[model samples]
Target chain A: MQRVSQRPTYKTIVSVAAAVAIVAVILALGAQKNFGPQQYGQLVVAGLGAGAIYALIALGFVMVYTVTGIINFAQGAFVMLGAMIAATIYGDASSGDAVGLVIAAIIAILATTLVGVAVERLTIFPARNADTLTLIIITVGVYIAIQGVGLVVWGTSAKAFPAFTTLDITDGTLRFWGIVLKTQTLWIWGTTALVLALLTLFLGRTLTGKALRACSVNKEAARLMGISPTRMSVFAFGLAAGMGALAGIVLAPATRPIYDMGLKLGLKGFVAAAMGGLVSSPAAVVGGLLLGLTENVAAGVTKSGLKDVFAFIVLIAVLLRKRGIFAAGTDLERP
Target chain B: MAADSYRSDTGTTTAPAGNGKESAPRRATMAGVVVLVALVLAIGLLEAFQPGGVDVSSLTGGVITFDTTVRIGILTIVVVGLNLLMGYAGQVSLGQAAFFGLGAYSSAIFTTRAELVGIGSGLEGRWWWPWLVMVLGMALTGALAYAVGRPILRLRGHYLAMATLGLGVMVTIMFRENLGLQLDTKDITGGSDGIPGIPRLRVGTFEIWPIERYYYLVWFLAIVGILLALNVVRSRSGRALRALHSSELAAETVGVDTARFKVRALVVSAMYASIAGSLFAHFRVAVSPTPFDFLASLELVVMAAVGGMASVWGAPFGVAAILAIRELVRTRLDLVIGGAGGEQEAVAFGVLLVLVMIFMPEGVVVRVKEVARRWSR
Candidate 1:
């Protein structure tokens, strides 16, 4: 009975500590001579934008883990591949303008979804019996394969077509106190919010969405219910991959996408997922955003080396704080 | 889907499967090891016999067998330790190389700074005393591993991998920062540029001369390491580890202290790596802090994975294979493929990783399995 009570007490302390920490951070940021209200606002917008990308990638990580009980390290590579394919489509002469870029985004999303489907069907499907680590190695193998192929098709030189400066209608910085806020930051926030609204709908209010959720919750039982977990895997991967691709296209104007961009981006995304206990799909998005804000703010306020250090610190804290962030079986309804 | 693929034109009237499908190709692994060893030895022998090239070795004469043998001995020991951790224990560790570099620096500091520290400053110091200090250095390094491995190894799967990887990165950063310890009075750890003048082991005027001697030295340690690993794996404790592969939860239910086993696995693996580090410091006669980062850890992971984990013989050969391929591409592939020649090797290895999946998913040893199956048939 004492042990039982202790568990909740442990949880309460952590939640309280987390709340205090966030309050302290915001208070501290507002208190800062350099980061006044306007700067904090801008930071939130930028953080949310970056966080959405991380959330999308985290979605794939959690979805795959739900069914397979293994983190697909290749998820990040998928994000990278999705972005690259999208960039390639847009690079072509047929799609060069704003309208064309939008079309290219759709084409790229479609192409990337197919790639995810192919990856599931061709590689991971056959190795069901292999150890979890072997599966990871296979994904790492997938990562290496994608890198080579991506590099071969597109050279090592970084590509940033359709620059990161679109939709800058605000076109000026918002100043209040000593803080500074960029117009693009606001644009990114608005765009991310719009995309997220659509995602929440598709996931919470649709039949196909329910099917995908069911598969992640329990592959075998979901199959018994005629959900074809394998097919769900394809679509789950597609949706997540598509989300990541959209992020890549959106952020392309901020920081250009490159072949190797996925690895680092993927790391941050996984951290975000883990941060949220891979719970409450929206938590992933919030976790990603929070992580981005924390890191960026930390970097701004302190030394840059802390960025990497900050990730592990958060990982250990959250991992210790929560149980089953990647708790399997959330994708499907409870039996 | 393929289960019903064999429904032929006879309306799927199949003969009841005779005595069920025989077990997977387990017997093939034994023969595969033999052939693979022979192939490796043949290649080694050929290379040893036909070698004529300008050596950029920093040593005087730059062709001593002792120094050359040292390099081989060092890498073998390090990779062997790695095999114990990743291959036997089923832990994906990329920190082996980092631990290795730490051991080297630890030992290197001990030997190079004895006089400055005012402990014993004369010819009375035995020639092999440097090695003795090196052992102490390794113990210290192993102690560090022990502290870190216990709590961190508790993390399941990739979380543990990332944590350990973080430790490696942290150590690498610290190693580079040139944080030196003042031993008694002298400066140890060589700071940034690293310790420059490490004396070579000499036998009077007749030094252990030539690169061939180093080859012999490496092979000797390699044999010892193989025997040690073989003995441990065959022991009762080894069975406990192998059992984890079968069913972790079930193994725990059966009275195996799973966490203790994991920690033990990590410590044992750390000791091997520490020994490797000591050998490297004494042999190379110089220690630097650049090559022991996360990438090296990844390369080590690649070695164990590509070789098919849980094999003692495969780990060393895997190392040799990766290094050889790297060296081969750097020197030879340049003429065949244009550009700086550096990127091609990584590209090729990446491609090889993918091909390993699609083809011999079990790796190159598949041929041996096939031969054994034919015998059985």
Candidate 2:
């Protein structure tokens, strides 16, 4: 114990050990549930796809919160803007091609990143001296503004992604030992994983990523070491917006991007961010996918239909637990 | 600037009762006189103009029919209560619509049921019973807010916002699903169709049916509400709220009971919403869950913030202005904007919110004050 206490980075090693054990348990239990090979396989693909989008938006939310010291209520609005612009540019109001969609989505992401920077630079920077409540009010005001803008541009009607054909060699079911996997779900799993793995690497190995993480943890020390927080904040916002645009694109097919989609998506992302303590990026990625799964699974089990009630139940449980809301003041006890 | 302590992370805080600080010799009559004059003008002008009716024809005409305006006016009062809670008090509550709905439904039931069960059988409750029901209903709702406030208020920022959002949604679901609360053995809430034919209000022999009459009544209520909110804002408790709004630590260190203040603010806001709802119940004679939702709550928040959160009188003006804008945007601009058939309003609302945040963060009140300052010279 004395030696352990004397060790410089003992807590860090312990954290890793705990993380591994918890992951191992979750995997073991996840494998034993209703999630058979087909379900498990589908969960991975679909989960990752959804997770990637959530990860990006969630990262943006956390990043903004890190520097501004408050949540950006407009983040989801930014996501919607990204998706809507992509949809519009990818095709005329009348129609579009495959390449057009891809190009438009990329442009939307890039453009929105600039928007992210501009918002932080102009709207947020001026009010850094304001109180938190004032800051919150400012953000809420921004949120309404974004919503209004969307309403003017897109109207209340829901927009649809271009039609697509499903390609499944197994024909909607991959039949191996009575387990069936859908092709679309399969794609989501792969894409999300690749992106998340890349993000993990970026945070661990890259200079920009390190700077962002460092700034998030300790802004003053980072500034002392010559990191331009303003630039980093903008960079973080850009990365998050780009990711949000991606999330919007991926999600559009499922929920169909509506003017109101941002509110719900933003709320869910906030939930996931809070659920993971807003400290762990990996946890957030997993947390978001799990939240989606939790809702769907709860709906399946209860049959009451998980629309409004499901979110409240999870939120209430998470909130009132003995360990502060989102595990505040309590260390994450790894299983 | 101490960057080390300047962490973005938020935590739950223990708020204390307000610091009782008086800035000026009590200009008590400035507020009182304003309410009295606004009331007399609102009522006297309507009667002088002879704005009367439930008639659809008059409503269709371009004239400012007294009835609809008054009903909307009353709704504004309820929203004012909501605004004070959200705007000045620094608490986000989405359950006002539910409280308003409940108040409207209960008040309707109180008066109508009294008329039905006791037709001079001595059990005939006082005509003012509806008023009682309104207060009781609002109080009960305020109690609900308090109950919801305790744990829910423990949430920080967005978490609180979403939780309040969840609360609003669940309450809507409850109103839709719960059978015991319905009227006449029908879904009586009429569910999606909404409850129409809400009985009109009566004050001593003055049969309040015309929107014009209700308009005066509502404005009267609104004036009262504004005054009440102003009192709350200027009160010792209001200061604590402002303190908590800035820094909970700073506020608590100064000996303010933050939790109690939050609860008080929430309850007071609910009461305001309840009063407004009661007026709405009598005026429109209709109430719907649809009108009171997350969007409604958001709109109220926007109204308060738009007018200026720090401004005492801005809440009422904000509600009045937003409603007027909605009417105008839908009516005056209908032809120009393809018969109001597009996402014009929503887009405008979003843009307005953004613009306010970006341009006038102090809200319209501050700008108005600035103009007044310049003009006074």
Candidate 3:
């Protein structure tokens, strides 16, 4: 038994060593390009900002998957809805209207949360007993439907969303040394940290959150214990949707919100969630940050057009490694 | 071989039935062949008699030209392969379009830039060049599917689905960005514009062109593809696939080699997409990345589902139904919604996919058959 256990530790060490070597090589390559610390700092900052949003979105993925055993494709659509609705409510907020923007953001998140609940109730809940493939396809359908509706309502034009700042929204950047940081980036990080703290506390302390966790651990056992799995499923969806909406609204100011922006962001978030084996929220947050940093730095070192490609490559690599190391036991194990 | 076992299993329960049980599948195959011949004859007659082709705009509320039929034929080949993989093998490939795009871009790049690719200008305009490229493309796509499927098919359900989706997006990006090649002089894949003016396919001196003649070639290959899929579904490997679909562990316990069978199914399906892609490139006389995007892959899945994934004969019907709906939306949606663009069609497809999966997971063909059987009784 000790020998069997020792194998994983050895494998983990080798994997960690390999990862370190690869990072060192990439850093050496970046140095050869003659880019100073300033450029590197900018890339790190930008990556972290993007990573924070991805972490928020990844939490939604982890939340839904643990409870429902579904990889919700429509999670991206919730993000899109939050951004689009918020933009619509606070039209042309790039000039600054702090109170108006806050009101719009609140309304958008609430509406999107309801949208998530409705999606689960109408589409997912009805077919709760169906196989995984059917459920996955259903979520995909929901995504397509939402995106279509978004197009019809908002048109194909990119909407303007203001950076959250007390000063003029247009001038929200802060410079320290040679590194420039957007105030919105700070907002994104702060918001993500607050949400994470709240989430940890809720799951750790609250009865409802514990019930939800119980359902995720084992649905039938939770049901036997008198916890309604169905209600918990609804709650999970709504909570995830709210998180997705928050991520989108915050992200919109950084990059102008388009109807189809969620597809890419949602996909990246899925990659992050997958990095956590689709089970651990904290791990997914770490995955998101790592993904963001790697892709940003890689793109900075190479061609920008290949930026999106790196996320998928990372996904494939992570999946392969996970399959190799966690082959015998994992959440992915089938009965 | 599996068909014989299936028949015998049923034969034992009804020994007195004799040859009656065996004739059912034979009859279905006969009906399929007859339908194909009839379709060909009807289209051939239409072309010979009405040179401009008949328009049934009033009936369908949309004009389905010969061009549309050609498209249906091309898509049928892909969807049939999809049916075998998804329906029989119970594997989902959200990146099937990548294989199709690979086949297309292979045909496009090789033929258009034969000299550029250092294959010399000699074979660039040869009649057999495109055909050779098509076969090579299928082989290449199959190899890729094997490499990808080995690792990917190991991840069941949602993990597999997401992995394939990521792959499809990655491949599409590669096509759009010219495989990340920064050539200052000449553009490979022509970048976003893609390769245009791809030469029409030919058999010696006879050119397959003007839409009418091309229809024959497309449908003929499509029929061949259908026949091939039907054969595979009835074979021992097909039974193994069905077993794997039900429960991989059980299949493995039976010594079915589930992993190998899954990978084989993926490879076969990919080859079918490659063939269809080649045909699409030749027929359209141009190749672009847009048609083989993630949405296109979803469209293929939708077709497989709508037509009854398990039924090989349902491929053409599924393609026709989807294309018909798309045409309907294109033509008539503006009147209903006012200035409806691509949005209405997307909504229609999305709703249709959800409704179909929820209400009739077995697909419309099987449901229709059940209804017909009931009504006949």
lDDT of 3 by residue, A65-156 (tens): 88877889999999999999998999855565678888999999999999999999998888787777777888999899899888888888
Error of 1 at B245 (Å): 2.9
Q: Model 3 over residues B1-377: C-alpha lDDT tens digits?
A: 11111111111122342366665566567788898779876866675576554543333434576678889999999999998898888888888899999999999989898776678888987899999999999999999999999988887777778788889989998898888876766567877789998999999988998788888888999999988887787678977887887778788999999989999999999999999999999988898889999999999999988888787888899999999888878777888987887677887888888888777777888788778779999
DockQ, ranked from best to worst: 3, 2, 1
Query: Can you write out model 1's per-residue Cα lDDT over B1-377, one digit (the tens) per residue?
Result: 11111011110012232344642222223453466456445434544664454233322133222333345446666666666676556666756777887777766666676655455755324676655666776677778878877777666556666567666766665565544231334345554567766665544543443545545545666667766775566566666775554556777989888777777778777777777776666667787776676657767767665554566655665666666566666666757866545666666776566555545444443334446669999
Q: Per-residue lDDT of B1-377 in model 2, one digit per residue for the tens?
A: 11111111001122223344632313333654476567557545645655664333244454334444564566666666765566555666645676666676666555554444233423224556667678777878888888988887766555566567777766776555532242455454455556666556677667775555665667777777766676666668767877776666688999999888887887887787777777777776776667676677677767766666555456556665776666656656767765564356665665566567556666776677667769999
Candidates by TM-score, descending order: 3, 2, 1
- The C-alpha stretches of model 3 lying farther than 4 A from their native spots are A1-10, A166-171, A323-330, A333-335, B1-22, B51-53, B56-61
Candidate 1 chain B: 10-residue stretch with minimal lDDT: B4-13
- True lDDT of residue B278, candidate 2: 77
The CAPRI-style docking tier of model 3 reads acceptable
Docking class for candidate 2: acceptable
Clash pairs detected, candidate 3:
none
**What is the per-candidate TM-score for chain B?**
0.76, 0.79, 0.92
- The local lDDT score (0 to 100) that residue A62 gets in candidate 2 is 62
Residue A306 in candidate 3 has what lDDT?
85
